[model samples]
Target chain A: MPTDTADPRYDYALRPPRLPQPVDESLASAPIDLDVRLEMYRKLHLLRQWSKRAHDLFLQNLVKGTTHLSLGQEAVAAAFSSAMRPDDYTFATYRGHAHSLSRGMDPGEALAELLGRKNGVLGGKGGSMHLTDVTRGMMGSYAIIGAHLCIANGAAWSAQMRGTGQVAVCFFGDGTTNIGAFHEALNMAKIWNLPVVFVCENNLYMEYTPIDLVTAVPRPAADRAPAYGLEPIVVDGNDPDAVYLVAREAIERARRGEGPSLIEAQTYRHGGHSRADPGKYRPQSEVEAWKARDPIPMYHDRLLKLGTPEATLTGIERQVAEVVDAATEFAKNGPEPGLEDLLVNVWADGGAEWRN
Target chain B: MAELSYREAVAYGIAQEMRRDPRLVMLGEDIAAAGGVFKTTVGLLEEFGPDRVRDTPISEQAIIGAAMGAAMTGIPVIAELMFSDFIAVTWDMIANEIAKTRYMTNGQVTLPLVIRTANGGGVRFGAQHSQSVENWCMMIPGLKVVAPATPTDVVGLMAASVRDPDPVIFFEHKALMATSEEIPDGEIVDTLGTARIRREGTDLTIAALAAMVPRALEAAEMLAADGISAEVIDVRSLVPLDTRTILQSVAKTGRFYTVEENPRVLGWGAELVSIVSHEAFWDLDGPCVRITTPHIPLPAASSLEDLAIPSVQKIYETVKRTIGGAP
Candidate 1:
């Protein structure tokens, strides 16, 4: 066993040392295409704008219930979604709008859910925290910090047992590292060598407390993975291209049955923890410094430098704007779930007895 | 019919289920290699191999949580929590997740999981290892709680539990694990909610569960010797209790006595008495009688523990008084 002192770079005090630039250099070196980069940039921008709209609606009392906004962590979801196959399973934490959008869930349904409209993904029963679309392989999102880790582990175990090459990804924040469920799920996943990618969107603050104060071992949360016999990778979460390349590699490794990997994406949340927080715990200078590394603008600049026409990007933005607007309108008009719907799924009616 | 011990019946049922369904698996600590702490799962690992009969780490939460996850994804898992007392550590996953998943998910998911754990306090395993929580599980709406007293009942109820679509918590009395009885071959017990009439009489009705069933039967025989005909009724399923059988028996006898190996207050005996009082209040000639372990936790010394639990003499005296035999 290698001791902590053996690797001086594995520091607990300072910020995590960034992985070598372009962790997947071969994939990054592939032929540059203008249209693909423009499309990616537009999708990331749409998520940011849509989150802002939802936040405003929440402030105006148009949306009811709690909503965890992922304003700054858009790139992690966008990159991972871009690398995933349509059939693969994905589970997320309470801040799940980006995950839902990335997995191709209707923006209209997403908006309606955020606005507490009847036509939401869960028929308005599960608000932002509980949005799900099984058809799109979005297994569901949970409010419990690390509870979904077990679910994802179970799903991956199921897929392996059934001989399906499909992989499952569990998305959680740095706060989840402190939970016992997280440790149990990770150990089981490692022992069984299940196909799971644990994506830790380390936004540094667990609600109001900073990660340094909460975690005894102050390091990129991923570095703790080796204790469970897993190789950990730290990536620049602010850069979409970097996140995409690393996520693709991790996904491929899991699909190949190499077991689970921990990818700690060092990112920041631009908004408060939820609709109720003003994010007063964070320093103004730190917020501005992170904003300068905003993934959408960086990817937009890279695409333009690669000869992607501005008109094409503008056209994609217009399409995203229309979809978001329509979803918002649809949610406003969607019917509320009736009281009868509540008791409908309580039991499975078997021929003689209820069976699953 | 063959003579079988209570533990053998449990093992036989599990072995039969493992042979019947390829997906039925058993998991627990030392269950595979050591044949279980009580030897209830003897020779299973050798018969089914490590995959089906798995040995787990000493994590009660993981054992139950993994079984829950497996149950959700098309597997019928029989997870053993070494002692029923340890269930408190994993109650969140067991009660909240496994028990409530079906109701919470609106029936989209069914947890076909059987949590088998040993309960009761006669062996003097002290306070931590010896507590009967069947009453606690009985309060949950979606769960089925069963405590079998005899070998035949153990085999029959276990088979029924494994086949049932919903989650079942099978509580086996550690003390009764050694008792032997005749179990009929190919005898399939139907209607888990129905109570069995272990002894028939006209003077008074004695209702008991698990280890208390034999004690109730012995008390009835003693009563019979004293000219008091006490009918012993084995209340197999606690949650979906056979209230009809109990009420019918009470109606005929005009008196009822409930015995349990649990604490007197808020125990299964209290629940049985409550049911009879509510349904057969007019039929009762005397107040419903209950013989249960004292409210205090089971003591470490065997002598004190014996006094704390209900015995045959206690049941006989309780029954005699219920039938107006003496003060």
Candidate 2:
């Protein structure tokens, strides 16, 4: 809730690198209205709190199984959600709890899913790693690296063929750039001229190893974009305004049937890859550096500077806290699905029986 | 009535459905302009136009994943993997994404798509391109697997697969492509999960699929000359396996034999044998036999390749030896 730039939670001494102008020159100075900015800020906080709570619950053994948290990467999800229309498709990776929330999925249903409760999204069948709700245009959160990029193109192809004008926004990690499907998807998207945006949330690390160590190129996603004939657009992923501007430009371009864009959002994860990984391999100093540039606090400071009322910010924080608390309680009290739930949904007949 | 080659039936079936539904789209390598490597999709590009019929890059992952994504949304797609053996490259998309999405999402999404691939060995395409990988897809939980033997069945089953609500892996046998059969002139649509009794006899039951079905039928004719009556059943769909028809045949004949194109270990026949043994234990007079290709990567040499896959001679000899020795 602190509005002061010198708040102890953030390290003001270590400045984030400035963005090298907007990717689309036409939208270089396009303004983000106060209302949209405030909404993005709200989404950022909601995501931050939801991810933090899920991590906490994991520690307590309430949220079973492993989960990948995007603690420091809320800006990309919030900014993209703000820019995209309600009906625009989103295909993201396992580290997409925040992305699902940003697309307006009820926190309670998502939390229930993570908790393996019966009332959860997908009826608790898809755990944290596979959180999906198609009704909200949150298509799916694929666990395998780089696969969703190709799948996203299929959605884009559908839109193009159907003349829906809907663009598919696929999200993945920097590690995905090394996968073959990533290349295949990009090349095919270009060849077919499909309406899709491939967003790479470059958290600087692929699991335990730093991306730079394994990746041959300096920039994993952006460097490879030119190979697919796409302009390499890299943005400050922690900066809400920078991500918002780039996301809006790329999304609009795809919606207009100009083919896909590869945007590399240089972000970082506050925690390890998953609940099991403590991320001991990463340097303490480097972790602290990325932590200092957390998207939540950075955007909070930006809003305060933009002349947002202090009371309004405090009220939003209060609202987010209550929503997170209610979601926690609902998930805790939710029911466990019965044994019969196992055989259902395997086929169209709603049963797993392969034989008559 | 009209006579169509198995390869021609593939195009006719797909076109039949594409004409019925505007949402159905087809994509594969060499399928559009080149009319497919097996010539199964000839005239489709011209019939449906390039918009519905597309030729993708040599990217199995993209082709299958795009089909899944399109299926998840409103559009239903039919993707071809060129050769069934190439499924190894894009197994994740077909097995993990397309198969599990509907179940994992609790029915929030339905993937209405068919992955048509040329399967089996006989024309010496080698190990990589000749595998009858229906077993690979059969083991997956959320997949519907169908392999048709005759041209008429190909057209009918293709329509059934396309119209089905779930993902179907259609195995078009490479060896059977040149074979032709007569069919009704009007729209021909066959039901999946139904076994066709190719030839009826009482001594034993021969269960087979795809390329193996013709060999089994020929073997039955050879057995009949020796007064050994054998009933050949074409097991069309593997996932919704016609266990009812198979169990009934086993109960009546008291003998069961599976002529499989896949290798000996863990073939689709293995599952059927397990089911028959458990369900019709009293009805079965002896152990079920599986005459299959040896567990080795298929050799490209013509003689060796012909020797490896199940042949009519092999089916006839295996059944005659097993039945003659049985109680």
Best by lDDT: 2
DockQ of each: 0.27, 0.80
Candidate 2 is graded, for docking, as: medium
| Predicted candidate 2 versus true structure: per-residue lDDT over B74-188, tens digit per residue | 7889999999989999999988888999889999999899999999899887889888899999999999999999999999999999999999999999999999978888898
TM-score of each: 0.86, 0.95
Estimate how well candidate 1 is docked, as a DockQ score: 0.27
Q: Runs in model 1 with CA error above 4 Å?
A: A1-57, A60-65, A104-128, A342-344, A350-356, B187-192, B201-204, B251-257, B268-280, B283-286, B322-327
DockQ, model 2, C-alpha based: 0.80
Model 2, A1-356: lDDT tens digits are 65556532333223232222222333223498989988998998899898889988888888998899988889999999999999999998999898899999899999999999998987889899888889999999999997899999999999999998999999999999999999999999999999999999998878876677689899999999899999999998888888899999999999888999999999888788898988755556667777777777766766776678889998999999999999999998999988978889999888888888
* Residue lDDT tens for model 1, B165-200: 778899989999999988898744555676889999
Which residues of candidate 2, in runs, are more than 4 Å off? Answer: A1-30
Report the C-alpha lDDT of model 1 over A207-258, residue by residue, as the tens digit: 8767766797765467688888987788888777777778889889989989
What TM-score, to 2 decimals, does candidate 2 have? 0.95
